[model samples]
Target: MNRLHPLSAVTYAIQYGFLWLWVPIVLVLALGGIFDPISPAWSPIAAPLGFLAGAAYGIAYYYRFEYGITPDTFDVASGVFARRSREIPYGRIQNVDVRQGVLQRLLGLAIVSIETAGGGNTEASLNFVSESEANRLQDQIRRRTAYVKEQRRTKQRSANEGEQQGSQRPTEPDADSSDADRTGAVSGAETDTPSDPTAVPPDRADRTDPDSTPVDGEEPDAERRAYASEPDRQRRQRLFDLQARELLLYSFTSFRPAAVAAVLFVFFLATDPIIDLLVATAQPVGGPQEIGEGTATNYGILTVVSMINGIVITYLLSVAYTFATYYDFELGRTGEDFVYERGLLQRYSGSIPVEKVQSVTVTANPLQRLIGYAGLWVETAGYGPESSGGSQSAVPLAEQSRVHRFTENLTDVETPTFRSPPTMARRRYLVRYSLVAAVIVAAVFGLAQVTALEGWYFAAVVFVAVPPAAHLKYVHIGYFVGENHLVVRSGFWQRRTTVIPYYRIQTVSTRRSIFQRRLGLASLVIDTASSRTFFWGTPTIYDVDLEDAREAHTAGRKRLQSALRERARDDDLGLTVDFT
Candidate 1:
């Protein structure tokens, strides 16, 4: 078993040190003036003891951990107290990702994470390995996975051929047969022979085509060698590269609501401490006295300024984060894999296997739509680096037409002509928005009566905007049933158009809420093996007529079944055999 680089010990020491440091501090605080009256005195020694404990644990862990790559699997053994060992088969590996942070880059170290289908997390992680070792491991695992899959296919094909030949063999003639039976059988065989003079014999048919026939002593994989000899530029197609201007636009448009929430949370947590510090610093040298109205006014002004500052800081941080994560993003396709490299601080390089891709999504927020820009995402099984809902951004920012073209090429489907939901659905949305507006207005009116709230009538503006908002929602909600894929589009704020191929679909369901039922509408939900769809919500044709929803569900199920059957038939006949 190979050990990680020696520098890994320092990384482990830092992690374990922090953890151990917390343990003693917490224990000292909890036990003070309780079980031991002198426990408070132990706080002074806690720091030194914590450091010693952390160092010992870190060293032990480094000594216990071991990992190695085998012919069939990647083996890992770890644990200081309890031994644990795992072997991940090469055939089951979905992705081998390599990442390097700022410190790792300075130290020439990297982290390798291996993911498998349905794992929902990295199956095995090798942390703090040398950069060169990380690259070797990734390439070796990829080659091994391909070799294993090819071997399995070859074995299955050979077994199938043997079974077919055995079934085709004629049964021996009965010993009781008369002489006339033997003579007839011989004549029948002679008649079965081809009579056309130009017909090629069965045994020599393959030899007729030079490309199909191998030269004497030639290798079986000569074609693969020729392919490998091709230039790198010809081997991979560049799909999209994030430009500086586009990246800036994407940073602004990709604002997350969570950032606002985080800012508010931090404000609340720090408000009391900040006020206390200010009060202490502002107190007169003579003595403390009641804060006057002027002082209170100054405090309020400061509070407002702080809030504004927090908002601005949060926005800047969000932009900085986007830049750091996608500074030099590039996406390309090599054979059956989509290779991507990104990151400004911590670089990442990985590939998404084409076979694992479940769907393609084109998304554009209202701002992006106004600017005619959109983003593309490819959803696949399992987890990936920098992925949201198991989706990796293929094109973070691009023109709408470019995004559409890329989506079409990836999915092998044309831009679908979407069918709008029935008019009843629009009426339903209008009623829903009107009710929401009424509720807000009523709440504002009640508050105005109980408190000195100014501009209470401003709440009425919601009612004025309700109609247009409802209309936009209705216009954006649509679905298309293409020949090979189901496309669903929805959301007014961040419109997303998802293309799910029938072959990747796992289940079809119809849901009808009480309101939907009252409106005589239902939703058709299409599920896939992709974890993204499960966590983020399935692709659904929402608020359609009940009959239409049922028809869509049935059609989706039928197409899924037919596609699966065709795939199985191809596999059985070896028509979809993969040599790489």
Candidate 2:
């Protein structure tokens, strides 16, 4: 058993007691009373009082909170008045995360967060522990958890063997009796010869047979055979690794629209302030005539300077953001998990269980494609694409050839040959895109009518692009159903190929909207534990022929069921972890 660091009092006060102390300060300020200590006039006096209060609360909390690790369970006792104690068994623990901010690092301390299976919140958090202690504790917990799981599996195997031998014991008795009689005759032992084998006395026939007995406490041949037939554990293998040059290349290739937009927004915000400063400085030196005479030229020069500054600012911000987020990206395979590590300022170390991964995606934007590189993203059981807010990429950038190798490691399936949707589906895509273009044109025309808008005709020019864009989109929308995986490739500019294992899929359905039905086309929708595609509509194989859609659905469903059966067998053998 151990207590947190002495400085934990300060951390706890800031973390838990800040609200309590600040509320009174806010109330005093709002009331506007000179007598109130936290009022603006008397704020100097309020600081000491708040500090004393925080110190008291922190000390009390430090004394009440305690944590300890037993052989199999991690126990935590915490409370100021109404104490609560929790015990988390090692077997159920899923993640042991350690984090340290600047202040914590300066104090040589870290926070250890323990998360368990099927729980949304952390099971326990030990704050302000020694950094080295946190790391040691995390390692010990993981090692013990693995050891416990192995012991449970061994017990299960032994119990199963016992049940199997018990079932076979009844049939073996008769054969053993005949063998024993033969042995007795050969050894010249006197034995009663019954007219019928069935007429033998039950007590006499119940004697143990030497032939059926295990020698030297060894296992039976049948049990040995069963053990031999069990599947081998997954071997550790390297898939893809990012080097220094590759990581630098990845920074340039990783183009995020959201980030670019943010830079542009910052540029826009800065332009007004800078232009106002220039105008303000010039206003004092110039009369109305002089100002009017040079106003157009001054505005031109300011516009040019601002444009240059904005571009430079955007470039620097983009580079800084990329470097900060993915400074030393690395992905590798361990026995049962794919370990992803990166970050310069705030280090991250996440080990994603291979079996928990639901789907993988190999994607390339225009810039990355030009560099002959692609990125990988994984969707796991709990982390869906929509909710995976950080960089979802497992391999931030790798050569196209390396992508297939990484996928094979994660999926245990080969890169599939994609088959495009029926050519007739192009009409649906074109119609949908044209309708969108028409809506935009209608909005522009309405704007022209309401306001003095110029170049309303220019908006109509967007119709020229609709056909080509729709055609490319149609060409890219393809699906492949492999022996054990489903691959879907889509997108016109930013191409993506998603590979999902059959076992990950939960449902398969063929859908037909009114328009799709009219065109004799249907969508094949495969739902997995976590859907990774970022589409407004369903993540599906859209606008395929009706019969093909049915076939795809049937094939996917059959494979899913087969995978479920295999998983069930693994469960029975105690090979799979029980997350719940």
Best-fitting candidate, measured by lDDT?
A: 1
**Cα lDDT of model 1 by residue, 103-140, tens digit:** 89998999998998775688888887888677656655
Q: How far is candidate 1 from the true structure (C-alpha RMSD, Å)?
A: 10.1
Candidate 1 residues lying further than 4 Å off, grouped into runs, are 22-39, 153-237, 272-312, 533-535, 571-580
Candidate 1 lDDT at 111 equals: 95
**Cα lDDT of model 2 overall?**
0.65
Candidate 2, residue 178: the lDDT equals: 83
Using all chains and alpha carbons, the TM-scores for the candidates as numbered come to: 0.79, 0.73
Residue-level lDDT of model 2, residues 240-312, one tens digit each, is 5678787778776655455668966765889777656555544444412232455544544554655665566
Candidate 1 achieves a global lDDT of 0.75
Worst 10 residues of 2 by lDDT: 202-211
Clashes by residue pair, model 1? none
State in Å the error of residue 57, model 1.
1.4
Candidate 2 clash figure, as a count: 0
